[model samples]
Target chain A: MIVLSSVSKWYPNGARPALIDVSVEIGAGEFVFLVGPSGSGKSTLLRLLLREERATSGQVVVAGRDVARIADRRVPQLRRIVGCVFQDFRLLPNRTVAANVAFALDVVGRPRHVVRSVVPEVLELVGLGEKADRYPDELSGGEQQRVAIARAFVGRPRVLLADEPTGNLDPATSIEIMSLLDAVHRAGTTVIMATHNASLVDAMRRRVLELGDGALIRDEADGRYDQTVPQPLSPSATLPPVVPPPLVMLPPAVPAPRGVPAPTALPARPAGQAPDAERSPWATPTRSGPVG
Target chain B: MGDTDAQWPGRLMRPGPLASLLWTGLRRNLAMTGAVIVTVTICLAMLGAGLLLRAQVHTIDGFLLDQIEVVVDLSDGITPAERSALEAEMRRDPLIAGVRYETKKQVYERFRRDFRGSPDVVAGVGPEDLPAALRLTLADPRASRDIAVTYTGLDGVEAVRDQRALLDPLYRFLDAFTVGAFTLAAVQALASFALIYTMIRISAHARRRETAIMKLVGASNATIRAPFVLESAVAGLAGGLLVAGVLVAAKVFLVDGKFARQTMFPLFGWAAVWESAVVVLAAGVLAAAVMASIALRRHLRV
Candidate 1:
């Protein structure tokens, strides 16, 4: 669990604060989307959670520890329980896929037997079991991200913070990644993903916490991406309802096998066509309508 | 997780993985590693050689100084009773270690033997021409000047010569050489430290990605730095061993073989060489480890 009370972060010599008096609480096992544009303090918030940076004012607590006050030496211990994933997939290019994953466990001083068992198991869970021996350069972008995901989840961290994980991937591959993350969330890990992908936010309809100009402007359950903008109820409205096509259909809560690669090549869709809700992988039919 | 944390220290105690990591780091930077080892070897070898040379000079200085004596020459017309009285007085003096009276015949024979290589010089000297004298060895060679002045111009004395005065130039030269050797060794030690620091910096830069990933994965600072420090330590160990070998070879081939065979002065023995070698070995390893640790602190923050 995480609690931030009126956290305000100011970078030295910066013209404005990065996060302005923002306070929000994220509970365990809840999949939350942190929606924001560029320079919206999403990455800063994630770094604060990881204790990579301290809050200039106010308390930031993660897993029952005040992150701002934790000693530098104890940062590693805090990191062990909080996993991070990045857009660039910061994998060691020279290392094999399995080695990259095992590194997470190895650094924490896990026994060899545990590393030997846990690495391959996590790789398999990310659907990269067959490419365990390949290097990052030898894998596709999607596969490399899968390896990064495997590494993040290898420790079974209590909270997973993803900073634009799908920023560099194609749309279909991004769907596969989202489905994988959804599976992880179903396994009872708290997932806080920051992204600018409007369609993914709209399609998933999870709890959305939006940031704008370093301020927490929206906190909505099952929210849409552009919910902050008031809807114009007139016939002269310029923008149509932006319903993207369902690119791939994945089995609910199951990791796809290696043999069946996610449908990465999207089929062209007619403009203004509303996607079928039944076909969207992220749609939860039992959830209530979007609440702001 | 708690169980794993309990076992974390025990896992580090296992040498297999840590050793492999150290080996991998060294292998990855083979050129730098070789440079470090070679630098340490040459630096420590020079230091050991300098120490041994200093020891040898000390031994020779002590030997030559022990042989210093004040020679009091007797006048040709001095009486037999006067010579007997002068020898008895010198024998009773505490300043003199020993006194030996030499007759003109014995002095002439010694002169002939000393100048046998130059026969013309020996032919010019005769038994009657050589001065009969009392050679007084001083308890302390440094007291040679005072004792010589005390006996100078005394009755039945022709001249008093302090051998220490004649050997002063040789001692000064030896002392200068010792200082020069030590200074050169100190410079080489600085060079070795700089080389090690540079090597660690380059290796840390080369493996930045690995270290950064380790930090991200919650590796402790010790765990992140162990391999780098250990690589330098291994190089130091190798270099120290090579220095010891070079020292032993220098002692056997240079000191005992060439110098011992060529000179009559007492030289330092194997025990002194081993002592210097051990000191050099320890200093090399400790310096390398310390420099590498410092460089890592600056270059590898994690």
Candidate 2:
């Protein structure tokens, strides 16, 4: 789970804040899309979640620990729990496919036996098991991105962050990559992807959060690609409310074995009920009046 | 996944992931490896040469000091008591290594033996013509001037002479040469460090993609840094060993076998060469490691 409360970020010497009083909450096991135009703060939001940059005010929490309070030495522990993928598919050109996947495990000091077993499993998952000996340059663009995904998933992290995973791909390849991410999400990893592809976002029909000028303009359930007139609240029409159980919803919040507190539990409500309007003040109040 | 997780990397002295990374880095940056090795080798060789020259100068200084001494001649009509007093004072001096008193007859005999090559010259010199003298050897040859001044106007002394002035020009030349060699070596060592720093920066730039990947995959800062440091250190070690081989060869084949026999001044032995080689080897490894670390701290933040 990821939570940001009134988070604001301003770079030094910049005329304005990159992110302005942004508050968000994402539950576990849900795939969400972060859509924005160029320089509209999509990358800055992701960077803040990764703790690459600190929030100027308020709390930034991931998995239950307030990241702003995490010490520098413990930053690696947080990073190991979170997996990231880049737009350019950053793979070592000199290493083979198997070596690339194995590197993730090796650096964390996993046992040799574990690394030996995990590399082939992840490669096979990505359907590149036979090309384990081929260097990255030898592979096509789709295959290289697949390798990057395989590396990100090798450690079985709870959260995956992808920054424009298909920005450089053709339409067909982009569909294939999105399907792979969908498959990963189905298997219980919370996936958050940021992109500028409108058609893909429209086709996915997942939860969409739009940003313009560093503000959260719209957050929709089964949302679409483009913004339209805000639909009036249907007092009788309820939101889609199949909130998957929180990662640690077994009623024991004191495990502390995961090195942090158990994730904040989702609102306990029956299906087909309206989302707590009080918690989503921006979603309700802005729809009732002009959005600044 | 507790302490064992942290300890896993600490035991990586063998061919684990970090070791393989180091090997791969060395293989990929072949040109950089060669440059670092060559620079380190030149630096160490110059340093070793300076050390060898310093050793030779010390040996030559020892030989020259052994041959220089002070001689005090007695005046006419000197009493035996005064002569005995002078001999006792010279012998009691802490600075004097040894003192020998020669009578007029013994001096004449020594003169006859020294002039045997020219019998006519020996016949021309009588026993009365030779003055009785006291020859004093000082512990330090550089103190000869002080001794000469102290004894020149003594009650029973005719004159005091120092033979060390004849060797002044040779000592001056050796001192200048030793200082020059060390200065050159120091300059070359600094140049080698600059070259190593540049090489590390280039190598890091070339591998930026891999470094970014590593960081995304959650590799620690130490893990990212180990390969560069290890590669540079290995290059320095190889360079040091190469210079050691050159030093040993020069000592065994050139200096000991040829120069020592011709000049009759002993050159450095195998022990000295090996000692200098060890020192150079340590210096090379230390310098490379330090240079690589500094460059990485500045350039390779990930």
lDDT of each: 0.77, 0.76
Query: What does fnat come to for each candidate?
Result: 0.34, 0.29
Clashing residue pairs in candidate 1, if any? none
Give per-residue CA lDDT, model 1, range A61-130, as digits (tens). 9877999888887788778778888888888876799988987777667878888898989898999999
Across residues B1-302, which tens digit of lDDT does each residue of candidate 1 receive? 21222224532413655676677788888988898898788877777777887887778657856776688899998999988888888888888889898998988888888788999888777789979988887887777888887888878999998877887876687778777777777887787778878878777766666776676767777888888888888888888899889889988898788988887778898888889878987887788888889888787775
Where does candidate 2 stray beyond 4 Å? A12-15, A27-30, A63-75, A108-111, A170-172, A186-188, A197-207, A219-292, B1-29, B61-78, B90-92, B104-152, B157-165
lDDT of 2 by residue, A1-292 (tens): 7877767677654456667666666777778888978677788888787777799786888888899898765666677767888777877777899998998888776778888898999899888999999999999898999999999988787788988999989889888889888978887888889987788888998877666656555556666767554542111112224533222222334543322222233233234432222221123234333321
Q: Report how far residue B297 has shifted in candidate 2, in Å.
A: 3.6
lDDT of each residue in B1-302, candidate 2, tens digit only: 11112234432222588878777778877887898798789888888887877777777657656876788889877899999999899988877899988888988898899789999999888899978988888898888888988888999899897877676776687678877877877887787778778878777766666666666666777777778888888988999999999999889888977787787555666677878899989988988888889888887876
Instruction: Fill in the DockQ of model 1.
Output: 0.16
Off by over 4 Å in 1: A186-188, A202-205, A222-224, A228-292, B1-7, B10-14, B34-38, B61-166, B234-238
The most accurate candidate by DockQ is 2
